[model samples]
Target: MSRDVVPTYVGTSFHVCSDRAADISRSGSRTSSLISSPSSVRTVTRRQSTSANTLLTLDPRRSRSPSRTESGDLIVRQPAKRVPLVRRTQHEAGPATPQSSAMSDAAKIQLVCTLGPASLDPDVIRKLDARGVDLFRLNLSHTGLEELAATVEFFRRHSEAPLSLDTEGAQVRCGSVVPDLVLAQGAEVELTADEVQGSADRLSLRPRSTFQALRPRSRVGIDFHGVLLRVIETGPASARAVVDRGGRIGSNKAVTIDPSPILPALTDKDVAAIAIGRRMGIDHYALSFATSGRAVRRIRELIPPGAHLISKIESRAGVQNMDGIIEASDAVLLDRGDLSREVPLEEVPYYQKAIARRANRLRKPLYVATNLLESMVLNSRPTVAEVNDVANTLLDGAHGLVLAAETAIGVDPVGAVDMVKRAIEAFERIPVGLDFTAPGAETDGALLTLR
Candidate 1:
């Protein structure tokens, strides 16, 4: 061994050979000295290396024993594994304030847009999806199941949020009207109890027998909120009426008799809507004439698992059963239009506040759905009052907002969405809550709202 040779410890055992090997070509005389003691000798065979790692083999017989490991040539210990971080459905998002630079791109309001001609393009749907439209509402009341299903697919393919189907539930409506036919005040209109399954596309001055069930002094309403009419004459062939809340009764408009105290709510149309909604991959069925908890359950039974049921407070029964309905439903829709007719128009604001406050207290996500952006239907701009109404509804802690004709068949669907988006930004800028998820913790709604 060279006098300069020194010993080193790799780990705690097996000493390396330092006495130079014999027989190759040296003139030096060296004595045989096993660097590895037989009692604690261990061996590590180096195999072929590959990739970014190397394979090492240690036969147990030659593996490091406790005795050898105390002074081993190589310390073979497992490397500490690194855990990959996975993110949840949560986002570190703040309020969507236009003025605040801290806004998170993921923060969004679950805006539900009704599908119609106004916004049908695939590209437009994609844009709306990216713009934070969280859900799509397919008004099954008017569209066929096939078309509705297709539209639902379109919506789903475009965005995976969810779809809401408005049931055709037994909402009364005026007979379909002819284009430009105006029902002036004091004008007589006829309806028939026996409605032909045939679609009524063109309006006729001729009276139909559908009004036979109506009695003298019977009050009928069109569009639910547009016009309130009274029966002047009733017969098998024709009925007559005068307009009170006189807007022109138009095509496919609803005709509702002032619900008697005895009339049961939610017609067969609503049941059909519920069935179709269940058939589709819809996430929610907005109960049209949800009068009570029973009414909501009536529809919920027919829906799929994880599907949400929303009771709409638009009728006297809904108002009377408000607490029960809210408790039964996953959410509730405060419809201003039907509320105007079912309850006195002047009382709507009061009820709106009452319902909103109660819904907020209960923690169920509440949505204010109606003609919020009505001005967008005509001009590209929305009225200031309309904007303020959106802001106020947000301030009241509504979880979602809806658009109707303004987005359904209006001229500028994108602009209407933009208008709504801008309104949301303005409303969120005026923060009222530290956290918006009031009802449930870690719920999808809560997570979305917090985002």
Candidate 2:
């Protein structure tokens, strides 16, 4: 007896054609063989009256290839290898189709704002959010978990934005000094591990490792926030250095050394910060002073599965291992503040361009951080140089721009964000096809491209 067969379609119907003899045989082997043969298969697709669906079917035996219709429907030929089927549905009353790639490209430049006293108000944060602030960064070096817990709770309660916790990674700084030391140029001072009330003559540097790593002739920048010192003598527990550039050095200020000394990638404080951040449901962590893929991997083991990692490259070692670090990180940040201290200040722009190029070529997001809008920290308006700097950074293919101290402790935090937003808008206005080449730009070390 001949049998009728039906093929299933979601809210649709399919008409199958088969030989009467094959259907009447009713033998399982024959039926299977008939169904498996390409020549014996014929299908007619029918659309439901209630819905419109576009289905592209490929004929395995047909030599004539399929082509597109004027209505924008695509027809594909069968491939040598098996290809998965795709279905597209169009609804008359549904929302328009989303162009995800275009939307992503349009908003590729992210704005990261650091939250502090000035920006902690709900009104300020909402304004920033409306202006396109993508994430809020918390500096652990300045605030502990206890203090940040309230901020975290506030964000969770008031906003849908994600938070990024930045660890104070292996930073060396001056400890408590009884009297802030005044080291004049050509004067000598001792950096010791011993806990002492530091004077102009002797200053205390904790972690002892910093002292052990010092050698004669080493250049030490005491508080780039303050003075510059050069080592004249080295000791087991202390190093005697002369002030190359003189200024008053105060307590709790950062120190930088040439050929950056060996220090732990993550400090004890950093470990504690990471633990606290994990508990606070932080979505991202910025690993400060990241130098290698190994260090990033170590950090990865600590963060939760879905949390993103941003590696801040702020040292020569980090520049040297840029490829590995970028490969291992979800994103890279060019922290110009600490980085300028390590390298000559004049070399910062070059390094920024090189790093930005690498990041762009790899398609990894790069954040140009620090000093973008420094003037806005105090003034209601940013300087012309600062505006140009912001524009050029965006033109250099930076995926994001970070507002550090400008937002963290600035007098006009919202104004700073607005200024940056305007800069970004101006950058976007530049004709996409414009040539950005400058005089001697090819040799000037800036990455210039014709988009």
* Candidate 2 residue lDDT tens string, 1-451: 0011111122332212212112222322122222333432334343432311122233444321222333434322111111111111111111111231323233346789998878888888888877768778888766655677777788666567777888777667776676656788998888888878788888887567887788888888876555888998898888899988898777656688764678887877778777877777676888888888888888888877757788998876787777788888878899988887776566576567557756655556788898998987888988899988886676455768899889888998889988888778766543232112434534652222322
> In model 2, what lDDT does residue 353 have?
59
lDDT of each: 0.56, 0.66
Q: What lDDT does candidate 2 reach at residue 76?
A: 20
Worst 10 residues of 2 by lDDT: 79-88
lDDT for position 311 in model 2: 92
**Model 2 bad stretches (over 4 Å):** 1-104, 154-158, 176-182, 192-206, 232-239, 248-251, 435-451
Score every model by TM-score.
Answer: 0.65, 0.68
Q: What is the lDDT of residue 216 in candidate 2?
A: 85
Q: Write down the worst ten-residue block by lDDT for model 1.
A: 79-88
Candidate that would win on TM-score: 2
Q: Return the top candidate by lDDT.
A: 2
